[model samples]
Target chain A: MTEWHDAAAADALSDDEVMGLSIAGVPVALFRQEGAFFALHDLCSHGAARLSDGFVENGCVECPLHQGLVDIRSGAPCSAPITEPVRSYPVRVVGDRIEIALNR
Target chain B: MTAMPESEATYVVVGGGQAAAWIARTLRAEGFAGRLVLIGEEPHWPYERPALSKEFLRGTGSVEAITLLGAAQAGEAGIECWLGQRVTAVDRVARVVTTAGGRSVAYDTLFLATGGRARRLPGLDTVPAERVHTLRTLTESERLRGALGGAKHLLVLGGGWIGLEVAATARALGVAVTVVEAAPRLCARTMPPVVSGWLHALHEANGVRVLTGTGVAGVTGTADGIAVTLAGGGRLEADHLLLGIGIEPEVGLAAAMGLALDDGILVDAQGRTSDPRIFAAGDVARHPNAFAGASLRLESWANAQNQAIIAAKAATGGTAVYADIPWFWSDQYGVTVQMLGLPGLGTRAVARGTPEAGSGCWLMLDDTGIVAGAVAVNAARDLRVLRKLLEDGRAPLPDAWTDSATPVQRLPSRPNVGMD
Candidate 1:
């Protein structure tokens, strides 16, 4: 069964912005890029750091801890030192609410 | 020796570290379908050394997690890795490298990424072997981590990056730590005075006793442990001691090969060594940095990766010059310290954030108001913008550079010198 939970308000993040959110004890990073929203595991694959604290540019998020770059849309690591990719969560937007499917 | 015909290009990279791994992968990535072999002295696969002092030592990083290349990746890349094999001699005229195991391999092009080893202090040859430690590889880190797990106190013998990092990790693991430095401040050679003071205070605030301007005169085994005598007539006894002094470049192999050496193997802009068919990179390659006026060796992670790319591309017949400003970072006790560009002597620093607040940025500017470098502590986001500004060789307004209200992204961009 698909489990959907309200993450935040649709307008909480502007274009090219990101924030940290927790869903069911799992840390998640929400990013708004080009009028759409994407979600990824909040933790960096290389170190113990939050992905939301990273810089977002050119459709990728640079890890604050190690400067490892990860593609936001696909959660694939696009740079060296980071071989693993963060898990991506499905996102849905309805009116002013942004929801995420945990798919538990 | 049988003279094998060199039909396919066989590229061999010496040393199994970051530089070796990158060169092997890059050679394949650059469409070199020939044979690639990596020779390493260590038994294990190539792993990151940074985590050894920080996360791995603190029990947070695992052995498998720190590996740079796994079995699957190596197989996929078709790289023949000869781990634990030491390259004793290279027959340059014959284009063959002989290993300690009596095996010889021929290569059309060779890369000397031999890297370096930790420097040892004098008069400590008899300090009860297990009591002294110097971290350089994963095996050394593992031994130190194991020793720290049962040890009560750790005495770090230097105040440099590795010393401070190990001190921080020791503190986190509930081990009493003391950092002793001969200099008056922390990171005296690499960081500015403000940063040094900040780090001294940061270590103090975190319960690690930091002693500056104090040198370890001698070490003797005591009834309890080892007694370390200080220069100023002070004494400290700790269960274990770690020497975190700088490293000595692995130039013996290159020197034996009759390559040019000045502190390190001299390389040109394309990472070519003294010989046209041979190249060097990473800590072992000392080349003239465009930013720094003289030839110097960089042992940072950034240099290992970027320089390997330049050397690999050049070996594969591509023109890639290594001109990027050197950058490095150190993580200690939750604070991430980063430095971009060469903030050497004569560069003035302007502060942007409060050092006492545990977050700050320092813009290193030349006399002509050009951005020469930047150092940031817990300010990685702002560092991204500062790096761009520094690369552009544009100067930020004096007021704006130091103003806390000025977001780095909003800093006015200036026309890059020689670009427009």
Candidate 2:
């Protein structure tokens, strides 16, 4: 836990909340699933739906536009209209904060 | 756990569709000597699906053009046809299936080609009888076909593949079809956004009213027809309502049998599920894919046939896994659309054909630098190569589509039987 830098404070996103941010102008959607923060590319695989506005369940987010699913962990298109994986970022949380690297 | 025929080798096919027909045809082609029994709920010989949403939905489709095999010929092939009888339950343990007519049929090996049912419009109330139509079964299609006048008002619900195909058909028949989909773009649940935009343009050019990001709130039936009220605060008046929304696999019989289901009858690559003997196919069987390492429920005609062949081979003691690259085709507004591999874009994509040009293919690539999947419209020849590349894990140079696309000279014709 000490090796990673803070990407966001704990208050930035609530439980089961997904928020979008940009690091170096690269759009990313951050999801707080099970007290852990994971990030995926903002664009949904099937269409131009924003993943930030989707429903999160069982470690995957369902796209709001057409219900295409993506795994929060691997950023892979889990089901329907999407079979490709979304690019994931290395996110780490420090004391009372969240941090993500822009390497993706 | 396919039962070795006990009583006179009864090969009871529980459903009648292209897959079932292919199983019967392939059995004859492979010189199978089992007594064939085809129990179809539809009361007609199997037909092609290419016409179901397009030509058949309009009034121009003739029955002869769609039916692949005549009943007499099927009879000659020793396939006893049972029409209008739906199988209610399947007792895999007893190796028997019961129909709605209180008839129990024992089988050596049963083929569940039950297929799927068209996803209905939300709320069953207030829908006009002939005005609302779901294009899946021939009975429903024929009804819609007969009711489609030369210039009528049609409101199609959903923006999926089936909805768009019906839209193309209704538009061609000089009918004003307004497709209302809650999704932001058409085919958003299937194709890439680039392709969805192209399809949106295709439907728009053909004079179809495509309203996205809106759901059908309710239906109002009147003397003229039905009026579809949208969630986005608009009303669509229509003489007929054609629903092409989508379909869910008919897993009623399978569910009744208490078999394992991972959204469908879960099966391994060889089509073996929890219960060994009872294998499922067509929109119902969810099989583990070697490439994805996940249980995938593939709902394509190609997958249906491929899985059936694999299931047959496996049943006949051939230990082969069905590992064919999934392929699907759609014809709309006189354009041939072929979808070949699958890829998670932003990883990579090589455009072989310009979808905007109304004809071409796109080669999708994965991080491993291999052809993950490919899609082409009116560029079948290129897709064949792409299919090879994907299945064989071959990656051509990044610019493969520039020199790869060629006019599809011909298509593999479905086998036809002579009337004589």
Candidate 3:
């Protein structure tokens, strides 16, 4: 089962920016790129680092701790030293608020 | 030696650390269907070493958290691992590696990613093993963590990255720490003098008594603690002592094979050793670095993974050169310190902001105004931009970079359109 949880204000993040927040007590990283919103688990799949603290470039987010690249839209690892994919969630902006669908 | 078909060729990687693990993974990813064998002396799977002195030492990270390649992943990737086995000899002519257990594995291509071992201070044989520690492996880190759990005062010899990180972790655990370094400044070998001063201040501010320009004359274990005599005739006592001088590359097998070695096994831009069929990477391979303008054997986590990937690709019929700008980072006391390129090659140091103020970067420019290196403290975002500028051989005017009104991402650089 999946439930949509309100994450933040639609205007809270600028284009090509990422913000980390908690929904249902689970850490989630929300990114806005080219006016589209994408969300993934906040933690890096390889190390104990927050992906939100990483740099977003191209179509991927670079892990600040190890420089591993993870695809933003799909949460798939795009580079070496990272083989596992981070969990991505469905995000949508509704009524001036961004909501993420999380499977509990 | 007989030439085997590509599908039947056996590739043997001797090492169980980051480099070896990556080599195996990359080989499989590159669709090398031949036999792959990975031999590592450590019993555990391949894992990153950065957390040994930080999270692992603080008991906040687990073995599972640091593991890079787990058993399930390795098994699925068709990698054969010989754990707890040390390579005793390498027959270059025969293309076979003999382990200490008398198991010999013949290979079409051999990779030496032996990495290194912690350099121990001489003349400490008299001290009890329980009181003195040197962290290089998971077992050593875990042992030291257990000791730190009950310790009140910890004495650290050598104020390099490992020593300082362990000291910081100990302080975080409410233990008093003292660090002694023979150099004039902390991390003097790699860091600039100004950055060394900043690290000294950071440690002192964190309640760590840092003794630069100091050396250890002797160490003796007492009934309840360890006593260290300074080279200048000063004495200090502590519940435990950690030696974090540096690492010595494991080059015995390489040397026995008569492979060219300078400080470490000499490798080309493709991570190819003296022999055509054998390759070396990671902390054990001294390869030519374009960024450093010299042959360097980097021990950072980035080098291990990057170089290994390059070696794996080159070994599997791919043309990839290992020429990435040398990058390294350290986390201490809530601060993330990152370095790109060779800061030692800089003639002028340009400050973007006050790094000591928590978030800033020091751009190291050469005499020709090229960005030779950079040191970023809690400014990883800027460091990413600086890495690109360094790679492009581009540099913004010092005034433009230093100006706080301009963002780093928007900094303009002189294009090298026609420059040779």
The TM-score values for the models, in the order shown, are: 0.91, 0.73, 0.93
DockQ of each: 0.58, 0.01, 0.62
lDDT of 1 by residue, B1-420 (tens): 123433377889999998888888888878888888999999989877889998888777887887776677889999999999999999899999999999999888999999999988889866788888999999899899999999999999989999999999999999999999999999988876767888899999999999999987899877656789998897999999899888999999999999999999999988999899899999999988876667879999888988988899988778879887778999888887898876544257788886457688887666655566678888887887776666666556656877778778777666423221
Model 1: DockQ vs. true structure: 0.58
For model 3, state the Cα shift of residue A42 in Å: 2.9
Per-residue lDDT of candidate 3, residues B1-420 (tens digit): 336677899999999999999999999999999999999999999888999999988998999888877899889998999999999988777778899999998899999999999998778888888998999999999999999999999999999999999999999999999999999999988887778888999999999999999978889989998999998998999999999999999998888889999999999999999898999999999999986778998999999999999999999888889999999999999999999888766667888889987789888776776667889998887888777676776666666888867867687777522223
Per-prediction fnat values? 0.58, 0.00, 0.58
Name the runs in model 1 displaced over 4 angstroms.
Answer: A1-4, B1-7, B344-347, B413-420
Question: In candidate 2, what are the lDDT values of residues B270-327, reduced to their tens digit?
Answer: 7766776655666778887765446678778677767766766665556889786667
**Which sections of candidate 3 miss by over 4 Å?**
A1-15, A19-27, A32-35, A93-99, B1-3, B415-420
Ranking by lDDT: 3, 1, 2
> Highest lDDT among the candidates is held by which one?
3
Interface RMSD of each: 1.4, 14.3, 1.3
lDDT of the candidates, in the order given:
0.85, 0.71, 0.90
CAPRI tier for the interface of model 1: medium
Clashes of 2: 14
